[model samples]
Target chain A: MEQQNELSFDTLVIGGGIAGSEAAINLANLNYKVILVEKDLSLGGKMIHLSKVFPTLDCAACITTPKVSETIRHPNITIYTYSEVKNIVKVSEKKFTATLVKKPRYVNEDLCTGCQECEDKCPVVVKDQFQYDLVGRKAVYVPFSIANPRVVNIDIENCILCGLCEKVCPVDAIDFTQEDVEIPLTVKSVIIATGFELFDPTQILRYGFGKFKNVVTAMQMERQLVPTRPYNSVLRPKDGKMPDNIAYILCTGSRDETVGNPICSQICCMYSVKQAQLLLGALPMADVSIYCMDIRAFGKGFCEFYQQAVGMGVEFHKGRVAKITEKENGNLILRYEDIEEGKIKEVEHDLVVLSIGVLPNPDAKLLFDSPVIESDEFNYVKQTDELLCPPDTNIKGVFVAGTSSGPMDIPDSILSAGAASACSANYIRN
Target chain B: METKKIKTIDIIKEKRTVSAEAKQNLKEYNKIKKLILKSLESEAKTIPQIAAETELPLDVVTFYLMTLRRYGSIETGEIDDMDEYFSYKLKK
Candidate 1:
């Protein structure tokens, strides 16, 4: 362990996602010193991975990139990427000291010029988790092209000692001698915007998500549609063939008692419809269908989008997919119960996407031990009043925002983050 | 506090030794890589064609093809109009 470094800030934000970034920027604009900690090498979270936002179908990166840049360049904000909040101890009503562990990136942040020389020369190739493991990335590479603090991180686990990256570096930025350091931060208030994780559909044995290559998650489909997509176009992973008939199975891991998550993951219905619309435009001759228990197009302009998808000839079936099996030619067979027709029917599609639900990030609980930040039955941070004080956690100076509180869309998440920032700012002022 | 400096190459060498499980995995990976290279030797072939000829799973073939493509061992030739799959040829 290296010598612990002590720093003080007006606020400490636990995540570097859209919500946390928004909160940090808002507080920084208010002339408050804020420290933002992220568990990944990059600042942008799930939003960066998305193709586009709902209803308006605006580019997701377009909305996130500016915020990430602003947060990174903000003078009042200090970002600690690839760091974790190990413990938080409350000393006073409005003061808390947090122990953070900053993992080594193996490259000196000040020396790296964000060039791709090291990445180009590195011979070790591993699955790129940013692309949902659909493609390969060099062992020494940045998280993405537009990543804030565009510095290369050496994947120490997979890196071979070939030293090609070091030899080819123009500025000699590659360094493997770095070790993890402990950072102690004292802050007046805390904001929890740690985002949600997608439910792993592989637990549902019948869905065959991992077993069948053609059956992918909704996020994987989003990756296929993004501008920085893994492939040239959307193709089935099993054979890299353009799929003519694609099926979307809604509520794969949500609203199911068996999976222990019974809440309706509020964004799945709209996103599935959005993806169906995008797929129709991308592959005009192909047939796109969505199987769901119900169409909950409850957001503003969302019902209109659903209607627009219907008008575009996208098929919407009111059914629950029972099982999915792969065919001999890498196609998928979907067995679903047709509630409208009152019969169980089988449909075949070249590709299938499982609209998995959201769950609270399991790390939120592990970050704090002092005030015992209470969480609801669903593991979302418990709010004093779900209607009134939505961002107020049991801890006095601590606030929860975004999907960390519950399931919400991008817009709602931004609003919740705004609320959290207001709450933290108010606490810091008084 | 007195601190000693260490070479990056020394640290990298210390961490690069493969475990038994990793050794087995590397062996399997090389075997699949060789099969893929052999399949693309005669002519350019699509992922499905290579998978069928080599009697390997399509996902396994796809993973190795991606690895080989990253290593500059394979290059995409053309998209087959019939199935819309890209043909990959071994790099000369």
Candidate 2:
């Protein structure tokens, strides 16, 4: 209890995604005592799933790994991976006490050296959740190559009741008996950097995502296209065939009231183009079509990059997709009214990639002392307009950043992360 | 010993906070009289420059500038770096 009560920091960050990861690192660099609490076992968030970043096409892992590494190594940062915030209380004015639920990894993280030998010996195999169920890994396995803390975890339910790991433990690190622990942390402020969740195409029903193997979400495609990704290459999961034509449906759940998110996701169009580039690069002969309403490249060099994507033989359809059907030969058939031709047309392709929209993460609504400010139905935080009397929220020191504000790309997320850092600093910066 | 060269941490020793001062104003116009006079002595700073000085996100800087202008505390003078930014100098 003393250990729990003794732990306190200047800031508590919920969600270890790009926004929280970056926000925690930024705050720690500013010399603020920080506790970065992530519900998942790893950081990096959706940014990790991305194969290549937009505008620059830099390797997503290459850029995100350093930030992950920095967050883990920063002296001021206390990272609680595989932990969830259970309660938040304002004990004093402008201060927050947060109770966190830390799920058991079932292995002694302090003693385990991340040696995968135990995983190799384990007889159980489970679907790698991080891979979108595209691949299988041992029940006791590291989530990814770059998971922060770089430690392995055991899937207790899937374990084959084998005691071989315990017999061969050099450090006695394997602990199947460890129970779930609750950690309480107090801080001056809290930042809800909980990133967005993917919109399920099953909501639209016309896409038939769960039934169609050829049809995939843009996130699934990213996992496939990323070289370091579990599968290592792109192929149809249905028949294991490398198809040459892929059609991308942009704004699948974005800008549609029936699907619930009507606001522009703001980043779908660019990521769609980037995925098109990756597809073209992977399979040079692949013919690609992007059914998009508009291409917004508002940032610096974004428009030019979009133009270059156009030059690279990716067709830009200025219309919405009406429907997609699975063909006999495991091909995806896209049927939509070409706004340009004013006629309904159908095209057959090996894969149909849904550029899904981003919405507020479900876990963002955890803080009890300070409430998350809502600007849109999508839950992007609203900002006060007047300069001198700008409207910050009920939370004294906490601020919003990245896609938590709306659907923004890496550059925009980075910009918001910086802004939140600045405004949060005004309260305690001196 | 080095003289405190032009105290960069320059702050007013006014007895009232900004909110308190606003409450004590004789009239809406008369109330902002000091703020107007104070803004006259400020100068505008660009977005990047402000980010460099304040170490904040560009969006926050632009956002805060907008708020300051609306409150008659700051004003925008020019566009640089392909985005419009404001100077920190007080608005008259």
Candidate 3:
């Protein structure tokens, strides 16, 4: 057994996503020591995978990469990617002890260059999760081109024990002997910025997500619009055909009691609209339509963005998609109820994108040992003083941020993170 | 150096446990990979053309071709003007 490592910090941020990264940077800038732990292999979270952010249409990676770089270079911030917080014990009002488990990447961070030699030599091929499995990756791969730390991880489950990656490595960084290391840390305050999970569209059999090859999640369509797109263009996944008619179904699992997530996923409307606009530009002749119960353009300049999409020939149909059936040619027949006309309608599209909603990631609550952090009926972290301080968790010195509390867009998530960091700093001072 | 490499392989074999399902998957993937490479040996072809030649599903052929493309085993050529499928060829 390896010797356990112990560290102490002023604050511990549970996620390395946008909110968590912002909070960590804020505290670090304030001369307070902060540790950021992320479960994935990289610092940039789901935001990095997006093509362009809503409203501004700014490149998503352009926004995330600099923040990730800043977070990495900050003197007062420590990051633990490919790690999870197992348990957090509140020792005192001003102090908490957290136990983290760091999973091995099988490549030494110090020696391995971001070179693709090992990835090229490896014989095994598996689904690339970063590309949403639209493409395949090698057994040993860097998660994505812009992954923070830009290191490769060995998928031991898929690796064939072929030793090809080990042999081909210029730095000999592959270390199969590496094991999971337990890290114990003492922090003065804790911030729960762990993010939300995308509602799986596969759960809705009526949408025909997995059953219909042309039907994809909104994230999958977003991936095709990026520079690192898998297909090089937004094409039908079934046959690689250029889609002539594309349909976006908003609120796939949101604002529906049957799906058990009744609250609106605030960002879906704008993101789907953004994708529709991008698709229209990419395939100029293709017709793009968005079917939604209603367009909830709530944020600043959001209504203008919606109107811009409408002006750009994005057909906005006020309707709720009931079910989808696939033709032999992989075209999807959407059966929907027209809310404006109060009539049932059916339409065919070459490709369909399901605008899935956000659901609360309840994994963060399990880390607490005493006075378990309370979550709402929907499993979002219960904001005890949402009106006064939206970040205040029930437990003193513990705060919540981002979609860990509820579904929010990027701007609101950042605001929530700022509030959480402010509340944490105030608690530590007092 | 060869002896040291063999020893490391032995260590991996001892330490790692490969499941039956995983082994079966590897075997299947290798077989499919060989078939796809063989079909692309003579000339560049689109995914549908490869699928037709190999008598495999379009998704399966696309998955392997994309993987090969990413890893530099294959390269994509111009799109077919008729059907819009990109022509793939074994990398020289």
Candidate 4:
């Protein structure tokens, strides 16, 4: 990537996800030259996908939007989306040289206006990933509503060789032939905020998500509930109508080692509570029950939020669902031993939502050397300790915050964002 | 004078992590009590002396001095202004 001799910055942040974004902002605010790199085409990270953050039923987009806007406006900060940090060389104890690959977005970034006609007209149809496949979009699309560097993309695979997009482009921005460009940079310190991904539910066949249309992941719920599109309205996928009762199964992929994640995801319980609360807040008629082994409300005001959910009439029975089978006539039969009752019980629900867990992004290991940062048994980044050094990673000058380090709610994500910023600034200062 | 021993920190995290009992009123004021008790025969030392000896949260140390005065544990009388430094003294 260094073949270009690009301008160097004081701090370089990998992963334009929440932690990295926060770190970049922190350093920039402290008057340090900062560069934030994101593999995706835009910023806001995973914090954007959540419907509402816990402790405050505040809209997720509302929290992330201002941060993205601020990052764009920071004079000391440079943002590189659709980019990857290829390599890093420790240049003495004070400087680090990095090789970065800036992937071609195919659209002339400079000329293509954010007018979004390219997104509207692009004939190639692909699953709208932001909506978690409940929706579809033309391959050339914006990542989400609150995306930074608001730009459109052209999906190379599904383009249909349609010159329609190229013909309609006012700036001749469509460049299907553009190849990957390598750039090199030198920075004083590098921070890794590569965020985690949702543990794919398909791996847990016993959950029956693939076997049934009614069963869905928590992420899918957030996407559907987001205002970007029409919410499916909590209806059963098969019948398209509200049901008498809804079941939310917490930690479907968390705190269970057989599925390969034994650590508590840390945010599932609270977000599940928020989901239940949101249901009660919006519908006021839906009966909700959450099945889980234990609730971990470790964040500020989190335990209060959990209690608030309980006060709102959520039945939080402690149990791991043993068998969930789709019953005929559009219902699910849940058979599990409720730890509180100490007896096996059966319940039927119209829709079942699995509070799925977060996993390290698949490409996380590829971009860095082994053990540069300490990871938990589940491969999530480990916080150095509970206090004093909240977002610090093992490597010097590289700090982590948000779910990139561990599972957290929105306020904690913002807190970590501020903490990461402080860490980055400290590194730059010293 | 609320100088909680090191053992109290562990007791908070391990014993009552989910309970309000974790926050307790300690036995003595942090360092002023230490200073006043140590200075039973004389007046209290300067702010710099207390700060130098106690690595405490800044606001916490201030709060204790204010509380001591409220409870008649220390009497406040300003000393000669040595340019920018202020000193406090123990009550009889």
Best by TM-score: 3
By summed lDDT, which 10 consecutive residues of candidate 1 chain A come out lowest? A157-166
Regions of candidate 2 where Cα sits further than 4 Å from its true position = A1-3, A369-376, A382-391, B1-92
Mark the 10 consecutive residues where model 4 chain A has the least summed lDDT: A230-239
> For candidate 2, lDDT tens digit of each residue in A1-430?
1124446888887778777877788788889988988878888988877788888999988888898888888999998988878668766655777787778786789998887777666544445678776555666788887677878887655554445565555777776656567667778876767778888887878887878867888887888887655432466655435557888898899889887788888888888888898889987878899998888778787898888888999999888888888877667778888899898998888888899998877566555534444454456555454244232544556567677656777876776676666666666554
Model 3 DockQ (Cα-based): 0.54
Candidate 3 per-residue C-alpha lDDT over A104-212 given as tens digits, one digit per residue, 9 for 90 to 100 = 8888988999798999887777789998888888889999999998999999898888888888888888888888899888999999989999999888999988878
DockQ for candidate 4: 0.00
lDDT of 1 by residue, A1-430 (tens): 6758699999999999999999999999999999999999999899988988999999999999999999999999999999999789889987899898989888988899989888877766668898788777777898887888899998877766667777777887878778888988899999999999999998999999888999999998999998777765788888888888999999988999999999999999999999999998888888999999999989899999999999999899999999888888889899988999899999899999999999988888988879778999999888887788889988999999899999999999999999999999998888
Candidate 1: TM-score, chain B only? 0.79
Q: What is the lDDT of residue A70 in candidate 2?
A: 85
For model 3, state the Cα shift of residue A132 in Å.
1.0
Q: Candidate 4 — which pairs collide?
A: A1-A183, A2-A184, A26-A421, A140-A153, B1-B28, B1-B29, B2-B28, B2-B29, B2-B30
Listed for every candidate in order, the interface RMSD values in angstroms are 2.7, 29.2, 1.9, 34.0
Look at candidate 3 and give me any clashing residue pairs: none
Q: What is the lDDT for A16 in model 2? A: 80
- lDDT of each candidate versus the true structure: 0.88, 0.70, 0.89, 0.69
Q: lDDT (0-100) at residue A334 of candidate 1? A: 92
Between candidates 1 and 2, the lDDT winner = 1
Per-residue lDDT value at A198 in model 2 = 83
Model 1 residue A184 distance off true place after TM-score fit, in angstroms: 1.0
**Candidate 3 docking category?**
medium
Q: Give candidate 4 regions above 4 Å deviation.
A: A1-3, A230-232, A369-376, A382-392, B1-92
